[model samples]
Target: MSLIEIILVGIGLSMDAVAVSMSNGMVYGTLPRRKWPLAPLFFGLFQGLMPLLGFFTGTLFAKYIDCYAELLILLILGFIGGKMIYDGFKGDKEKAEERVLSLKLIFFQAVATSIDAFAVGIGFCAINVNIFFASSLIAATTFILSSLSFCIGRKFGDLLGNKAEIFGGTILVILAIKAIL
Candidate 1:
Protein backbone atom coordinates (compact mmCIF):
# COMPACT_ATOMS: atom_id res chain seq x y z
CA MET A 1 0.00 0.00 0.00
CA SER A 2 1.06 3.56 -0.58
CA LEU A 3 1.95 5.76 2.38
CA ILE A 4 -1.23 7.79 2.01
CA GLU A 5 -3.37 4.68 1.98
CA ILE A 6 -1.53 3.28 4.98
CA ILE A 7 -2.05 6.50 6.89
CA LEU A 8 -5.73 6.54 6.01
CA VAL A 9 -6.08 2.99 7.22
CA GLY A 10 -4.28 3.89 10.41
CA ILE A 11 -6.64 6.76 11.02
CA GLY A 12 -9.62 4.53 10.32
CA LEU A 13 -8.30 1.84 12.66
CA SER A 14 -7.48 4.25 15.48
CA MET A 15 -11.06 5.46 15.95
CA ASP A 16 -11.73 3.02 18.74
CA ALA A 17 -8.53 3.93 20.52
CA VAL A 18 -9.35 7.58 20.02
CA ALA A 19 -12.78 7.15 21.54
CA VAL A 20 -11.31 5.28 24.48
CA SER A 21 -8.60 7.88 24.95
CA MET A 22 -11.23 10.57 24.97
CA SER A 23 -13.10 8.73 27.65
CA ASN A 24 -9.88 8.36 29.60
CA GLY A 25 -9.27 12.05 29.32
CA MET A 26 -12.69 12.82 30.71
CA VAL A 27 -12.05 10.50 33.63
CA TYR A 28 -8.46 11.40 34.42
CA GLY A 29 -8.40 15.03 33.46
CA THR A 30 -7.37 15.95 36.97
CA LEU A 31 -4.20 13.88 37.11
CA PRO A 32 -0.83 15.50 37.73
CA ARG A 33 1.36 16.21 34.70
CA ARG A 34 3.85 13.44 35.52
CA LYS A 35 1.21 10.75 35.48
CA TRP A 36 -0.33 12.01 32.26
CA PRO A 37 2.00 9.91 30.17
CA LEU A 38 0.44 6.72 31.46
CA ALA A 39 -2.66 7.03 29.29
CA PRO A 40 -0.88 7.74 26.02
CA LEU A 41 1.83 5.22 26.74
CA PHE A 42 -0.65 2.45 27.35
CA PHE A 43 -2.68 3.43 24.30
CA GLY A 44 0.27 3.82 21.96
CA LEU A 45 1.90 0.58 23.05
CA PHE A 46 -1.24 -1.45 22.52
CA GLN A 47 -2.09 0.26 19.27
CA GLY A 48 1.43 -0.45 18.00
CA LEU A 49 1.55 -4.04 19.14
CA MET A 50 -1.83 -5.23 17.90
CA PRO A 51 -0.96 -4.73 14.22
CA LEU A 52 2.33 -6.56 14.67
CA LEU A 53 0.51 -9.46 16.22
CA GLY A 54 -1.97 -9.36 13.35
CA PHE A 55 0.83 -9.18 10.78
CA PHE A 56 2.53 -12.27 12.15
CA THR A 57 -0.73 -14.16 12.36
CA GLY A 58 -1.68 -13.07 8.88
CA THR A 59 1.70 -14.11 7.56
CA LEU A 60 1.00 -17.69 8.49
CA PHE A 61 -1.94 -17.93 6.09
CA ALA A 62 -0.81 -15.42 3.49
CA LYS A 63 -0.37 -17.90 0.73
CA TYR A 64 -3.80 -19.41 1.08
CA ILE A 65 -5.72 -16.14 0.70
CA ASP A 66 -3.67 -14.18 -1.79
CA CYS A 67 -6.34 -13.97 -4.46
CA TYR A 68 -9.03 -12.51 -2.24
CA ALA A 69 -6.86 -9.99 -0.43
CA GLU A 70 -8.68 -6.81 -1.46
CA LEU A 71 -12.05 -8.30 -0.78
CA LEU A 72 -10.91 -9.38 2.65
CA ILE A 73 -9.66 -5.90 3.44
CA LEU A 74 -12.93 -4.37 2.33
CA LEU A 75 -15.00 -6.77 4.36
CA ILE A 76 -12.99 -6.31 7.53
CA LEU A 77 -12.88 -2.54 7.33
CA GLY A 78 -16.54 -2.30 6.43
CA PHE A 79 -17.59 -4.57 9.23
CA ILE A 80 -15.57 -2.68 11.82
CA GLY A 81 -16.66 0.71 10.61
CA GLY A 82 -20.29 -0.28 10.43
CA LYS A 83 -20.16 -1.66 13.93
CA MET A 84 -18.69 1.52 15.34
CA ILE A 85 -21.42 3.60 13.75
CA TYR A 86 -24.06 1.26 15.04
CA ASP A 87 -22.63 1.33 18.53
CA GLY A 88 -22.41 5.08 18.61
CA PHE A 89 -26.05 5.40 17.67
CA LYS A 90 -27.05 2.78 20.21
CA GLY A 91 -26.66 5.53 22.83
CA ASP A 92 -25.40 3.32 25.60
CA LYS A 93 -23.88 5.68 28.05
CA GLU A 94 -20.87 4.36 29.95
CA LYS A 95 -20.92 5.97 33.35
CA ALA A 96 -18.03 8.40 33.40
CA GLU A 97 -17.12 7.76 37.04
CA GLU A 98 -17.42 4.02 36.78
CA ARG A 99 -14.82 3.64 34.05
CA VAL A 100 -11.20 3.10 35.04
CA LEU A 101 -8.09 3.01 32.91
CA SER A 102 -6.40 0.09 34.55
CA LEU A 103 -3.98 -2.32 32.88
CA LYS A 104 -6.68 -4.81 32.08
CA LEU A 105 -8.92 -2.11 30.70
CA ILE A 106 -6.17 -0.77 28.49
CA PHE A 107 -5.24 -4.19 27.20
CA PHE A 108 -8.80 -5.10 26.40
CA GLN A 109 -9.54 -1.78 24.80
CA ALA A 110 -6.42 -1.98 22.66
CA VAL A 111 -7.23 -5.44 21.47
CA ALA A 112 -10.84 -4.56 20.78
CA THR A 113 -9.90 -1.51 18.79
CA SER A 114 -7.24 -3.20 16.68
CA ILE A 115 -8.94 -6.43 15.82
CA ASP A 116 -9.78 -5.09 12.37
CA ALA A 117 -6.14 -4.24 11.82
CA PHE A 118 -5.35 -7.87 12.31
CA ALA A 119 -7.53 -8.65 9.33
CA VAL A 120 -5.89 -5.83 7.45
CA GLY A 121 -2.59 -7.48 8.17
CA ILE A 122 -3.91 -10.56 6.50
CA GLY A 123 -4.68 -8.41 3.46
CA PHE A 124 -1.19 -6.97 3.62
CA CYS A 125 0.26 -10.43 3.33
CA ALA A 126 -1.89 -11.15 0.31
CA ILE A 127 -0.91 -7.89 -1.35
CA ASN A 128 2.79 -8.39 -0.67
CA VAL A 129 3.07 -5.13 1.28
CA ASN A 130 6.01 -4.64 3.62
CA ILE A 131 4.73 -5.61 7.05
CA PHE A 132 7.30 -3.51 8.87
CA PHE A 133 6.42 -0.28 7.10
CA ALA A 134 2.68 -0.83 7.27
CA SER A 135 2.77 -1.71 10.95
CA SER A 136 5.06 1.21 11.73
CA LEU A 137 2.81 3.67 9.95
CA ILE A 138 -0.22 2.25 11.71
CA ALA A 139 1.48 2.52 15.08
CA ALA A 140 2.72 6.05 14.55
CA THR A 141 -0.58 7.34 13.22
CA THR A 142 -2.50 5.70 16.02
CA PHE A 143 -0.16 7.16 18.64
CA ILE A 144 -0.51 10.66 17.34
CA LEU A 145 -4.26 10.42 16.86
CA SER A 146 -4.79 8.82 20.26
CA SER A 147 -2.76 11.50 21.96
CA LEU A 148 -4.57 14.27 20.16
CA SER A 149 -7.92 12.72 20.98
CA PHE A 150 -7.11 12.77 24.68
CA CYS A 151 -6.07 16.36 24.52
CA ILE A 152 -9.16 17.29 22.58
CA GLY A 153 -11.39 15.49 25.00
CA ARG A 154 -9.76 17.21 27.93
CA LYS A 155 -10.30 20.59 26.39
CA PHE A 156 -13.75 20.09 24.94
CA GLY A 157 -15.38 17.35 26.96
CA ASP A 158 -17.55 14.80 25.12
CA LEU A 159 -18.92 17.27 22.68
CA LEU A 160 -17.13 15.65 19.78
CA GLY A 161 -16.78 12.18 21.22
CA ASN A 162 -19.54 10.42 19.30
CA LYS A 163 -18.95 12.53 16.26
CA ALA A 164 -15.35 11.41 16.06
CA GLU A 165 -16.34 7.79 16.02
CA ILE A 166 -18.95 8.45 13.37
CA PHE A 167 -16.46 10.27 11.19
CA GLY A 168 -13.86 7.58 11.60
CA GLY A 169 -16.38 4.94 10.80
CA THR A 170 -17.50 6.75 7.69
CA ILE A 171 -13.93 7.05 6.53
CA LEU A 172 -13.32 3.36 6.99
CA VAL A 173 -16.47 2.44 5.18
CA ILE A 174 -15.58 4.67 2.30
CA LEU A 175 -12.11 3.24 2.09
CA ALA A 176 -13.48 -0.26 2.14
CA ILE A 177 -15.89 0.50 -0.66
CA LYS A 178 -13.12 2.11 -2.65
CA ALA A 179 -10.88 -0.89 -2.19
CA ILE A 180 -13.57 -3.26 -3.36
CA LEU A 181 -14.36 -1.18 -6.39
Candidate 2:
Protein backbone atom coordinates (compact mmCIF):
# COMPACT_ATOMS: atom_id res chain seq x y z
CA MET A 1 0.00 0.00 0.00
CA SER A 2 0.99 3.59 -0.55
CA LEU A 3 1.85 5.87 2.37
CA ILE A 4 -1.56 7.53 2.26
CA GLU A 5 -3.28 4.19 2.15
CA ILE A 6 -1.19 2.98 5.07
CA ILE A 7 -2.07 6.05 7.10
CA LEU A 8 -5.76 5.60 6.28
CA VAL A 9 -5.57 1.99 7.31
CA GLY A 10 -3.95 3.09 10.56
CA ILE A 11 -6.85 5.45 11.20
CA GLY A 12 -9.38 2.71 10.58
CA LEU A 13 -7.55 0.37 12.94
CA SER A 14 -7.27 2.95 15.70
CA MET A 15 -10.98 3.69 16.11
CA ASP A 16 -11.62 1.01 18.71
CA ALA A 17 -8.56 2.02 20.69
CA VAL A 18 -9.81 5.61 20.54
CA ALA A 19 -13.16 4.58 21.92
CA VAL A 20 -11.59 2.54 24.70
CA SER A 21 -9.31 5.42 25.64
CA MET A 22 -12.26 7.74 25.73
CA SER A 23 -14.16 5.26 27.86
CA ASN A 24 -11.29 5.08 30.31
CA GLY A 25 -11.28 8.84 30.63
CA MET A 26 -15.01 8.94 31.15
CA VAL A 27 -15.11 6.12 33.64
CA TYR A 28 -12.11 7.30 35.62
CA GLY A 29 -12.58 11.02 35.22
CA THR A 30 -9.43 13.11 34.72
CA LEU A 31 -6.48 10.96 35.67
CA PRO A 32 -3.23 12.28 37.10
CA ARG A 33 -1.24 14.24 34.52
CA ARG A 34 1.57 11.72 34.82
CA LYS A 35 -0.81 8.87 34.11
CA TRP A 36 -2.44 10.59 31.16
CA PRO A 37 -0.53 8.64 28.50
CA LEU A 38 -0.85 5.24 30.10
CA ALA A 39 -3.84 4.00 28.14
CA PRO A 40 -2.71 5.38 24.81
CA LEU A 41 0.77 3.98 25.32
CA PHE A 42 -0.55 0.48 25.86
CA PHE A 43 -3.00 0.89 23.01
CA GLY A 44 -0.27 2.04 20.65
CA LEU A 45 2.26 -0.48 21.81
CA PHE A 46 -0.06 -3.42 21.35
CA GLN A 47 -1.50 -1.95 18.23
CA GLY A 48 2.00 -1.86 16.74
CA LEU A 49 3.17 -5.13 18.18
CA MET A 50 0.17 -7.24 17.17
CA PRO A 51 0.44 -6.37 13.50
CA LEU A 52 4.16 -7.14 13.43
CA LEU A 53 3.48 -10.43 15.15
CA GLY A 54 0.72 -11.11 12.68
CA PHE A 55 2.96 -10.31 9.75
CA PHE A 56 5.48 -12.77 11.10
CA THR A 57 2.83 -15.33 11.86
CA GLY A 58 1.68 -14.86 8.27
CA THR A 59 -0.93 -17.37 7.11
CA LEU A 60 0.48 -20.13 9.26
CA PHE A 61 -2.18 -19.72 11.91
CA ALA A 62 -4.23 -16.80 10.64
CA LYS A 63 -7.28 -18.97 10.21
CA TYR A 64 -6.97 -20.34 13.70
CA ILE A 65 -6.46 -16.91 15.22
CA ASP A 66 -9.42 -15.49 13.32
CA CYS A 67 -11.63 -18.25 14.60
CA TYR A 68 -10.96 -17.23 18.18
CA ALA A 69 -10.34 -13.47 17.98
CA GLU A 70 -13.98 -12.42 18.10
CA LEU A 71 -14.82 -14.57 21.07
CA LEU A 72 -11.81 -13.30 22.95
CA ILE A 73 -12.69 -9.68 22.29
CA LEU A 74 -16.30 -10.29 23.23
CA LEU A 75 -15.45 -11.93 26.53
CA ILE A 76 -12.84 -9.39 27.57
CA LEU A 77 -14.79 -6.28 26.67
CA GLY A 78 -18.08 -7.74 27.81
CA PHE A 79 -16.74 -8.55 31.24
CA ILE A 80 -15.20 -5.14 31.71
CA GLY A 81 -18.30 -3.43 30.37
CA GLY A 82 -20.50 -5.49 32.63
CA LYS A 83 -18.47 -4.46 35.63
CA MET A 84 -18.66 -0.81 34.67
CA ILE A 85 -22.39 -1.07 34.22
CA TYR A 86 -22.72 -2.68 37.63
CA ASP A 87 -20.58 -0.04 39.26
CA GLY A 88 -22.55 2.72 37.63
CA PHE A 89 -25.81 1.34 38.97
CA LYS A 90 -24.47 0.44 42.41
CA GLY A 91 -25.24 3.97 43.70
CA ASP A 92 -21.81 4.28 45.19
CA LYS A 93 -20.54 7.52 43.73
CA GLU A 94 -17.54 7.71 46.00
CA LYS A 95 -16.29 4.30 45.00
CA ALA A 96 -16.91 5.00 41.34
CA GLU A 97 -15.05 8.28 41.54
CA GLU A 98 -12.19 6.66 43.34
CA ARG A 99 -11.74 3.89 40.78
CA VAL A 100 -8.13 3.58 39.73
CA LEU A 101 -6.96 2.73 36.24
CA SER A 102 -5.32 -0.67 36.25
CA LEU A 103 -2.46 -1.65 33.96
CA LYS A 104 -3.91 -5.10 33.55
CA LEU A 105 -7.19 -3.62 32.43
CA ILE A 106 -5.41 -1.36 29.98
CA PHE A 107 -3.44 -4.34 28.69
CA PHE A 108 -6.64 -6.22 28.02
CA GLN A 109 -8.19 -3.24 26.29
CA ALA A 110 -5.12 -2.87 24.09
CA VAL A 111 -5.18 -6.50 23.04
CA ALA A 112 -8.91 -6.50 22.54
CA THR A 113 -8.78 -3.39 20.42
CA SER A 114 -5.83 -4.61 18.31
CA ILE A 115 -7.11 -8.03 17.27
CA ASP A 116 -8.37 -6.69 13.96
CA ALA A 117 -5.00 -5.16 13.32
CA PHE A 118 -3.49 -8.58 13.61
CA ALA A 119 -5.79 -9.71 10.83
CA VAL A 120 -4.78 -6.71 8.82
CA GLY A 121 -1.17 -7.73 9.22
CA ILE A 122 -2.03 -11.16 7.95
CA GLY A 123 -3.49 -9.49 4.89
CA PHE A 124 -0.30 -7.50 4.58
CA CYS A 125 1.54 -10.73 3.89
CA ALA A 126 -0.18 -10.80 0.50
CA ILE A 127 0.76 -7.22 -0.27
CA ASN A 128 4.00 -5.33 -0.96
CA VAL A 129 4.01 -3.08 2.10
CA ASN A 130 6.74 -2.75 4.70
CA ILE A 131 5.30 -4.19 7.90
CA PHE A 132 7.50 -2.22 10.25
CA PHE A 133 6.72 1.15 8.69
CA ALA A 134 3.04 0.35 8.50
CA SER A 135 2.89 -0.81 12.10
CA SER A 136 4.71 2.30 13.27
CA LEU A 137 2.27 4.52 11.42
CA ILE A 138 -0.63 2.61 12.87
CA ALA A 139 0.78 2.96 16.38
CA ALA A 140 1.35 6.69 15.94
CA THR A 141 -2.16 7.16 14.65
CA THR A 142 -3.66 5.25 17.56
CA PHE A 143 -1.60 7.19 20.08
CA ILE A 144 -2.55 10.60 18.73
CA LEU A 145 -6.24 9.83 18.31
CA SER A 146 -6.53 8.00 21.60
CA SER A 147 -4.79 10.83 23.43
CA LEU A 148 -7.20 13.38 22.01
CA SER A 149 -10.20 11.16 22.69
CA PHE A 150 -9.28 10.75 26.34
CA CYS A 151 -9.42 14.50 26.79
CA ILE A 152 -12.76 14.68 25.04
CA GLY A 153 -14.13 11.91 27.22
CA ARG A 154 -12.90 13.61 30.36
CA LYS A 155 -14.70 16.82 29.42
CA PHE A 156 -17.89 14.95 28.62
CA GLY A 157 -17.58 12.91 31.80
CA ASP A 158 -17.57 16.12 33.79
CA LEU A 159 -20.87 17.05 32.20
CA LEU A 160 -22.40 13.57 32.38
CA GLY A 161 -21.47 13.24 36.06
CA ASN A 162 -22.23 9.88 37.61
CA LYS A 163 -23.83 8.47 34.47
CA ALA A 164 -20.55 8.56 32.58
CA GLU A 165 -19.58 5.06 33.64
CA ILE A 166 -22.86 3.64 32.44
CA PHE A 167 -22.51 5.45 29.16
CA GLY A 168 -18.93 4.25 28.76
CA GLY A 169 -19.91 0.71 29.61
CA THR A 170 -22.73 0.78 27.12
CA ILE A 171 -20.33 1.93 24.43
CA LEU A 172 -17.96 -0.92 25.24
CA VAL A 173 -20.72 -3.53 25.14
CA ILE A 174 -21.87 -2.15 21.85
CA LEU A 175 -18.31 -2.29 20.54
CA ALA A 176 -17.96 -5.86 21.75
CA ILE A 177 -21.13 -6.85 19.95
CA LYS A 178 -20.05 -4.96 16.89
CA ALA A 179 -16.72 -6.78 16.85
CA ILE A 180 -18.42 -10.14 16.69
CA LEU A 181 -20.78 -9.09 13.95
Candidate 3:
Protein backbone atom coordinates (compact mmCIF):
# COMPACT_ATOMS: atom_id res chain seq x y z
CA MET A 1 0.00 0.00 0.00
CA SER A 2 1.00 3.61 -0.50
CA LEU A 3 2.02 5.84 2.41
CA ILE A 4 -1.39 7.50 2.50
CA GLU A 5 -3.03 4.12 2.25
CA ILE A 6 -0.88 2.81 5.05
CA ILE A 7 -1.80 5.76 7.22
CA LEU A 8 -5.47 5.24 6.45
CA VAL A 9 -5.19 1.59 7.37
CA GLY A 10 -3.51 2.55 10.60
CA ILE A 11 -6.35 4.85 11.49
CA GLY A 12 -8.96 2.32 10.47
CA LEU A 13 -7.23 -0.42 12.43
CA SER A 14 -7.02 1.75 15.55
CA MET A 15 -10.75 2.37 15.93
CA ASP A 16 -11.18 -0.45 18.44
CA ALA A 17 -8.13 0.55 20.41
CA VAL A 18 -9.42 4.10 20.40
CA ALA A 19 -12.74 3.00 21.81
CA VAL A 20 -11.10 0.80 24.43
CA SER A 21 -8.74 3.58 25.41
CA MET A 22 -11.66 5.91 25.67
CA SER A 23 -13.40 3.34 27.83
CA ASN A 24 -10.28 3.12 29.90
CA GLY A 25 -10.64 6.85 30.38
CA MET A 26 -14.35 6.47 31.05
CA VAL A 27 -13.62 3.88 33.68
CA TYR A 28 -10.57 5.65 34.94
CA GLY A 29 -12.14 5.99 38.33
CA THR A 30 -11.76 2.28 39.01
CA LEU A 31 -8.05 2.57 38.39
CA PRO A 32 -5.34 4.13 40.53
CA ARG A 33 -4.49 7.84 40.35
CA ARG A 34 -0.79 7.69 39.53
CA LYS A 35 -1.00 5.54 36.44
CA TRP A 36 -2.25 8.28 34.14
CA PRO A 37 -0.05 7.34 31.21
CA LEU A 38 -0.83 3.67 31.32
CA ALA A 39 -3.81 3.67 28.98
CA PRO A 40 -2.23 5.14 25.84
CA LEU A 41 1.15 3.59 26.52
CA PHE A 42 -0.13 0.05 26.69
CA PHE A 43 -2.46 0.51 23.73
CA GLY A 44 0.20 2.17 21.61
CA LEU A 45 2.86 -0.35 22.48
CA PHE A 46 0.79 -3.34 21.53
CA GLN A 47 -0.73 -1.59 18.51
CA GLY A 48 2.74 -0.86 17.16
CA LEU A 49 4.41 -4.12 18.00
CA MET A 50 1.78 -6.72 17.07
CA PRO A 51 1.89 -5.85 13.36
CA LEU A 52 5.66 -5.88 13.31
CA LEU A 53 5.74 -9.24 14.97
CA GLY A 54 3.06 -10.46 12.61
CA PHE A 55 4.90 -9.20 9.53
CA PHE A 56 8.11 -10.84 10.60
CA THR A 57 6.61 -14.15 11.59
CA GLY A 58 3.19 -14.24 9.96
CA THR A 59 4.16 -16.24 6.85
CA LEU A 60 5.60 -19.02 8.92
CA PHE A 61 3.10 -18.81 11.76
CA ALA A 62 -0.17 -17.85 10.05
CA LYS A 63 -1.44 -21.38 9.58
CA TYR A 64 -0.65 -22.30 13.14
CA ILE A 65 -2.41 -19.23 14.46
CA ASP A 66 -5.33 -19.06 12.02
CA CYS A 67 -6.98 -22.08 13.55
CA TYR A 68 -7.13 -20.53 16.98
CA ALA A 69 -6.86 -16.76 16.56
CA GLU A 70 -10.57 -15.99 16.56
CA LEU A 71 -11.26 -18.19 19.53
CA LEU A 72 -8.43 -16.68 21.53
CA ILE A 73 -9.52 -13.14 20.77
CA LEU A 74 -13.08 -13.96 21.66
CA LEU A 75 -12.14 -15.54 24.96
CA ILE A 76 -9.68 -12.92 26.07
CA LEU A 77 -11.84 -9.96 25.13
CA GLY A 78 -15.01 -11.67 26.34
CA PHE A 79 -13.49 -12.36 29.72
CA ILE A 80 -12.30 -8.82 30.16
CA GLY A 81 -15.53 -7.33 28.88
CA GLY A 82 -17.50 -9.67 31.09
CA LYS A 83 -15.49 -8.68 34.13
CA MET A 84 -16.00 -5.02 33.39
CA ILE A 85 -19.71 -5.55 32.92
CA TYR A 86 -19.90 -7.50 36.15
CA ASP A 87 -17.87 -4.94 37.99
CA GLY A 88 -20.03 -2.11 36.73
CA PHE A 89 -23.11 -3.78 38.11
CA LYS A 90 -21.84 -4.56 41.59
CA GLY A 91 -23.25 -2.56 44.48
CA ASP A 92 -20.15 -2.10 46.54
CA LYS A 93 -18.11 1.07 46.00
CA GLU A 94 -15.02 0.24 48.06
CA LYS A 95 -14.20 -2.88 46.07
CA ALA A 96 -14.46 -0.89 42.92
CA GLU A 97 -11.48 1.19 43.92
CA GLU A 98 -9.44 -1.83 44.87
CA ARG A 99 -10.07 -4.00 41.83
CA VAL A 100 -9.85 -3.41 38.05
CA LEU A 101 -6.94 -2.43 35.77
CA SER A 102 -4.87 -5.44 36.68
CA LEU A 103 -1.67 -6.20 34.77
CA LYS A 104 -3.44 -9.14 33.23
CA LEU A 105 -6.29 -6.89 32.23
CA ILE A 106 -3.95 -4.43 30.61
CA PHE A 107 -2.09 -7.18 28.79
CA PHE A 108 -5.28 -8.68 27.47
CA GLN A 109 -6.70 -5.34 26.36
CA ALA A 110 -3.48 -4.59 24.50
CA VAL A 111 -3.38 -7.91 22.72
CA ALA A 112 -7.10 -8.15 22.11
CA THR A 113 -7.26 -4.71 20.59
CA SER A 114 -4.31 -5.39 18.30
CA ILE A 115 -5.32 -8.73 16.83
CA ASP A 116 -6.39 -7.05 13.58
CA ALA A 117 -2.90 -5.72 13.18
CA PHE A 118 -1.61 -9.24 13.39
CA ALA A 119 -3.88 -10.14 10.52
CA VAL A 120 -2.60 -7.15 8.63
CA GLY A 121 0.90 -8.49 9.09
CA ILE A 122 -0.23 -11.73 7.55
CA GLY A 123 -1.46 -9.80 4.53
CA PHE A 124 1.77 -7.84 4.43
CA CYS A 125 3.63 -11.00 3.50
CA ALA A 126 2.00 -10.83 0.12
CA ILE A 127 2.85 -7.18 -0.51
CA ASN A 128 6.15 -5.45 -1.25
CA VAL A 129 6.07 -2.43 0.99
CA ASN A 130 8.62 -0.99 3.40
CA ILE A 131 7.85 -2.84 6.56
CA PHE A 132 9.49 -0.38 8.89
CA PHE A 133 7.78 2.64 7.38
CA ALA A 134 4.38 0.99 7.36
CA SER A 135 4.75 -0.33 10.87
CA SER A 136 6.00 2.98 12.24
CA LEU A 137 3.18 4.94 10.69
CA ILE A 138 0.65 2.46 11.95
CA ALA A 139 2.04 2.59 15.47
CA ALA A 140 2.31 6.36 15.57
CA THR A 141 -1.20 6.85 14.30
CA THR A 142 -2.62 4.41 16.80
CA PHE A 143 -0.74 6.11 19.63
CA ILE A 144 -1.99 9.55 18.69
CA LEU A 145 -5.55 8.44 18.11
CA SER A 146 -5.65 6.16 21.14
CA SER A 147 -4.19 8.84 23.39
CA LEU A 148 -6.56 11.55 22.24
CA SER A 149 -9.55 9.27 22.35
CA PHE A 150 -8.70 8.20 25.89
CA CYS A 151 -8.59 11.79 27.06
CA ILE A 152 -11.88 12.61 25.37
CA GLY A 153 -13.53 9.43 26.58
CA ARG A 154 -12.37 10.15 30.11
CA LYS A 155 -13.91 13.58 29.97
CA PHE A 156 -17.19 12.24 28.70
CA GLY A 157 -17.12 9.39 31.17
CA ASP A 158 -16.71 11.85 33.96
CA LEU A 159 -19.76 13.71 32.79
CA LEU A 160 -21.78 10.51 32.51
CA GLY A 161 -20.87 9.57 36.09
CA ASN A 162 -21.21 5.97 37.34
CA LYS A 163 -22.94 4.71 34.25
CA ALA A 164 -19.84 5.39 32.20
CA GLU A 165 -18.21 2.18 33.32
CA ILE A 166 -21.21 0.19 32.26
CA PHE A 167 -21.23 1.94 28.95
CA GLY A 168 -17.53 1.36 28.54
CA GLY A 169 -17.91 -2.27 29.38
CA THR A 170 -20.72 -2.56 26.89
CA ILE A 171 -18.57 -1.00 24.22
CA LEU A 172 -15.88 -3.58 24.86
CA VAL A 173 -18.31 -6.43 24.66
CA ILE A 174 -19.67 -5.13 21.41
CA LEU A 175 -16.20 -4.69 19.96
CA ALA A 176 -15.26 -8.17 21.07
CA ILE A 177 -18.27 -9.62 19.35
CA LYS A 178 -17.59 -7.62 16.24
CA ALA A 179 -14.04 -8.98 16.09
CA ILE A 180 -15.19 -12.55 15.77
CA LEU A 181 -17.95 -11.91 13.24
> lDDT scores for all predictions?
0.65, 0.91, 0.80
Tens digit of lDDT per residue, candidate 1, span 1-181? 7889889988887876786676556544545566656666666666666667667786775555544645765676577668656755754566323334466655555655565666677667667677788888888888888888777666644455545445545655665676557
Q: Order of candidates by TM-score, top first?
A: 2, 3, 1
How does residue 37 of candidate 2 score in lDDT? 96
lDDT of 2 by residue, 63-110 (tens): 999999999999999999989989999969688757998999999999
Off by over 4 Å in 1: 59-100, 158-181
Whole-structure CA lDDT of model 1: 0.65
Ten residues in sequence with the least summed lDDT for candidate 3: 28-37
User: What RMSD does each model have against the real structure?
Assistant: 7.1, 0.8, 1.9
Worst 10 residues of 1 by lDDT: 91-100
Instruction: Give the best candidate by lDDT.
Output: 2
* lDDT for position 130 in model 1: 78
The digit string of per-residue lDDT tens for model 3 on 1-181 reads 8989999989988888898888888887545557756766777777778778888896788877777777777887777777778888883677556656666777788888887788788788789978788888888898899888877887887798777778888888888787689
The whole-model C-alpha lDDT of candidate 2 against the native structure comes to 0.91
Provide the global lDDT of candidate 3 against the true structure. Answer: 0.80
Model 1 / residue 15 / CA error / Å? 0.9
